[model samples]
Target: MKYRYFLILFTFFTILGACNQPISQTSKASAKKVINAAPEKKIPIDTSKAFKFNDNWVVPKSSLDFNSLGDSQGDTLKLAVCGDFVYSPFGTIKDSSAFSSSLLKNFSIVTRTEKMDNGTFNFQILNHGSSKLIFFFDTDPEASRHSDIFKGEIYDEDVQFVNGIRIGMSFPNFYKTLFDSFPDDLTNNYTVVQIISCVDDIIQTYDFDAGKLKSVKFITDSYWKVDY
Candidate 1:
């Protein structure tokens, strides 16, 4: 009878120990899962001084006119004015011999050569002037491709387009301001905004992807007609 009582006590202790073991293991597993599933902290963005300006702040003007502006207009467009400038078939007019000298005087040129699939070559001039102007050119001399400014980009706040349109302006503000200033030049398909200049035979395209001004492109009518 004593042995039977001892056997019953052993069985009771064994079951209690099994229950306690699972309880402790389950608690540890739950704690591990909680730690693993914890969300990571995120850094907050400060927007208080987002639109503040520094000393180099350039107040954008209202509009730019080709006829009235003279050589200043040519300087702004990075194109050579009439006088001794030779016109290229690609729509660029400059004294090719004096091109390097002129660029040296005005811009710090960083040239990048790129080869095309058709065995032709091209050059990209980055940070051309204070406006961060980028110019694309055909580099091959033997080929019909003229060494001319095929494309240009402007992203500097100091360089403003017609009617206060600038680099950092919001899409809504730019569109509204541009339309308010030059209503005739504005055209949009909701995806792209374009300001066409019949006088220069050039189109200035504004790309506002992230609700802000992303980039501005100036392409010749020849390019827009043939390639674009």
Candidate 2:
């Protein structure tokens, strides 16, 4: 009887040990639960208030003496009511002054128009980055290039002002010449201009060196419409 009791006790412990062995199922399930838990981004619901604006930066009387850095009154762009910052998206693969100018030349293809009701208007920003431009249109979709506006936005991939500020500067008339080179119909009621130049505002300045952006200034307190 003593032998049998010892045998039974040993068998019970062996079974208990087998049952207690660490199982792989529980650990894997716990790990998966932890791995799958993550949050998602929330986009805005209301962006119904959007409208487009024109630019009014004028050109110097003499194209030969025009200075991109200063001495540019660029008036036609102002008449269009633009004259601020704009956004441009790009990649690090392509960059240079002539290439950037070629990219700017293509900005005319990016045109968006929506019917408005009185003063109700709004616009939205697309993917952000440096690779695009904004020029004013001379309202004349027909006269090759109207005195109204002549502009578009595109990336230059060629010009860099240090710390990844790749861009090119142009007077309103420079855009006018580009627009005039085309043979499209321009009208007076709704014009086009190439004076729209901004990265995040109607102003021509950008401040990404900081956390948030700071807009550029043209004539005192004049700034582009802020959407954010």
Candidate 3:
């Protein structure tokens, strides 16, 4: 009878020990699933700072329109202009002049001519004293028959695009701010990313070198280089 009682006591202790054991693998997995099933909270995007600037820079607004001058009427025309500069097929032009004496007064202008198969093409480069900024102008009225020729590089911090892009800005932040996506690694050569406007006729190119913006090109797709 004592042996029987002892056996019952031993069985009771064994069951209690089993109850104290760690949870099963299946129970752990179920708990993990329950935790993972909870909805994740998302951060709201700030519309005010999304694509806006306080400066005088203007963002191009697109409107429904077709390229009237192009061969295909269905092709959309995207022309980007920043401040006083207008983009064309050849280059960017400022103040609607290939060589503006009023604007060039502050800077030294160097003019040169290139002999082409059909004719001679004129080119001009404007340089400021001790400034790294340079502007290249196409002076050939016949070569750029559609628009004036002007291309420039901006190294000033005071100058900022409408989307808050500026020289020396980090590539990741610029990419995230402009595109809202993570940027890929850029090589030594400048990585060119073109921004096309849907609502307006505007196409802008941002060139990044060494993880910073090197230059910006505003292009008008409607214009093409005049065959010499």
Error of 1 at 131 (Å): 6.8
- In candidate 1, residue 192 scores what lDDT? 50
TM-score per prediction, in order, is 0.32, 0.24, 0.38
* Model 1, residue pairs in steric clash: 62-163
Candidate 1 lDDT by residue in tens digits, 1-228:
999999999999999988877557888999999999999994442333121122211121233221221222211212122211112212333433444444223445565555555554434354544444334443446644232545567666555442456677876686465222222122222335554442454555666656667677766644322121
Can you rank all candidates by TM-score, best first?
A: 3, 1, 2
For model 3, the local distance difference test gives 0.46
lDDT of each prediction vs. the true structure? 0.45, 0.31, 0.46
Instruction: For candidate 1, give the lDDT.
Output: 0.45
Model 3: CA > 4 A from native: 24-151, 180-190, 196-203, 218-228
Name the weakest run of 10 consecutive residues (lDDT summed) in model 2: 145-154
**Per-residue lDDT tens digits of candidate 2, residues 57-165?**
2232221122132222432222222121122222221222222354233322333443344333222222124333323222334633111111123233343321233
Better of 2 and 3 by TM-score: 3
Candidate 3, residue 10: Cα displacement in angstroms equals 1.1
**The candidate that achieves the highest TM-score relative to the unseen native structure:** 3
Off by over 4 Å in 2: 34-155, 160-228
